[model samples]
Target: MRGNHVIAEAAIRAGCRFYFGYPITPQNEIPEYMSERLSKIEGGVFIQAESEIASIHMVIGASMAGGRVMTSSSGPGISLKQEGISFLSALELPAVIVNMSRGGPGLGNIAPSQSDYFQATRGGGHGDYRTIVLAPNSCQEAGDLTYKSFDLADKYRIPVLILGDGMLGQMMEPVELPPEIPVKRLPPKEWTITGAKGRPSRFIRSLILDPFEEEEHNWKLMRKYEKISKEELLWETFSIEDAKMIVVAFGTAARIAKGAIKRVREEGLKVGLFRPISLWPFPTKILKEISRKVKHLFVFEMNMGQMVEDVKLAVDGGAEIHFYGRPGGIIPTPLEISRIISSYYYQKKLG
Candidate 1:
């Protein structure tokens, strides 16, 4: 299946009954597929929203009403959704947002790039809120993680982001759809303003002017994030026990890095790979443990030193940390990565 199609099917199986989004390159297939399939289901609703802002709000509204909702977009569209995302976080609405990143600070080309790292991992919108961001490296993961994103969102009562690049969105691979897991329905919306009941109306506002009240709310949010960091950090390690050097990467960049690691191994270099599946609640403890064993670490990404920062924080300078990447749709090929690793290996030997 194509990656976007897999994600669409997975969303339906995850009980995502409402999908509101605008068409964006590389990911338009998701909304397009939903258009064809969602209406076939009894309760499914698919809307081509006027804009990304409207789309995100629509999802939030649906979520507030005790429905599983989702939206998909690319970089520019994602920027438009940030405001609503912050609103969702403030309200603690459970929703999923998929970003199949293309190039850009603005209207960049429709090609794969990991340039949106800061925007996704860091809060792209205003205020103190964190998004649980998942990075999927392959077409299968693209589907599986999209489903998992919704579960995580519901578990944390926060928005979850499935971060992918155009390459992952466009790629085709075999994917086995997981068995339908029962959707954990939220309690009745007594707190949500479904309608004016006989009792006092409920309000959904993201405003707290009092200093102490705001501090308390912020602290609660922080505690939730800390708990998430402890429980949700996820990663994959390949052949690191005897590794002299470790390659750190995530999403599609990690797939390329894995290929490079295979090539270097063929040439008799003891290189291993570590790929983080969760970008925000990064697998810091595991990376730190691996860092103590490896003498050197190389971080590969499609952007300029975004995940590298996290690697440095994890390793804490225990091992030499190096970086290599290309920005704005320029992909680092397996051979190119191999050359980079080979050069670093020789440089370290001489040093």
Candidate 2:
């Protein structure tokens, strides 16, 4: 399955019947697929809004009405949707926002890049809130994690981000797809503004006029975020036992690093791989635990050192950190990274 198509189909299986989004590079297939498939499902709604901003606000509206909704875009488009994403967080709405991220700062390129790490993990929107960010490396993970995003969003009543690069979004792979969930069997959202028949009327609002009330709301958000950080952390490790060095990466970069690690290990290298699945609730505790046994950690990214900062903070000077990056949409070859790893291993005398 094509990566973007997989995500769209997975969203459908996860009971995401409402989708509002605009077409954007590298990720246009996501919305395109939604536009086609959603209309076939009973009660499904798909809207190609006038713009990215308009699409995200539409998502907010659908989510407020207690529907499983999603919106997708690339970097530039996502930038336009940030204010709406902030509003979703403020309103405690459940929606999935997909960013098949491409090169950026400002419409950099359609080529594969992980430069949006900062934007995705650091709560790209303006506010005192955070969204759950999931990074999927392959078409299978791209589908699997996207299916799970909706549940996480509704469970926590927060926005969930699916962060994928152009490579992951365009790659073709065979995937074990999940079973489609019947829409009626989906989880109930009691807080939504559904018709208030015979019940006290309730309204949804993000605006808290009182400073004290707003502060309390922000704190409330923080506490929920803290709970997610503890319970929702996800990561993957490769052949880490008795390893002297570990390479830290995520998504497409991590897939490349995994290949590089395998190549080097064939020649008796002690390097392993650590791939974070959830970017926001980073696997800090586990990474820090690995830092105790491993002293050298190599960080590789498609961008100019975004996730590396998270690694540095995770280990906190307890280990030696080396970073390699390819900015401006350049995807490095596995052999090139393997050679770099070998050189660093010998130079640092890590065996």
Instruction: For candidate 1, write residues 225-266 as lDDT tens digits.
Output: 999999998899897877899999999889999999899999
> For model 2, how does the per-residue alpha-carbon lDDT over 285-347 read when each residue is reduced to its tens digit?
999999999999999999999999999999998999999999888899999999999999999
TM-score for each candidate, following the candidate numbering: 0.95, 0.99
Q: For each candidate, what is the lDDT?
A: 0.89, 0.93
Best by TM-score: 2
For all predictions, the C-alpha RMSD in Å is 1.9, 0.8
* Runs of candidate 2 exceeding 4 Å displacement: none
TM-score of 1: 0.95
Count backbone clashes in candidate 1. 0
User: Cα deviation in Å at residue 181, candidate 1?
Assistant: 4.4
User: How far off is residue 95 in model 2, in Å?
Assistant: 0.5
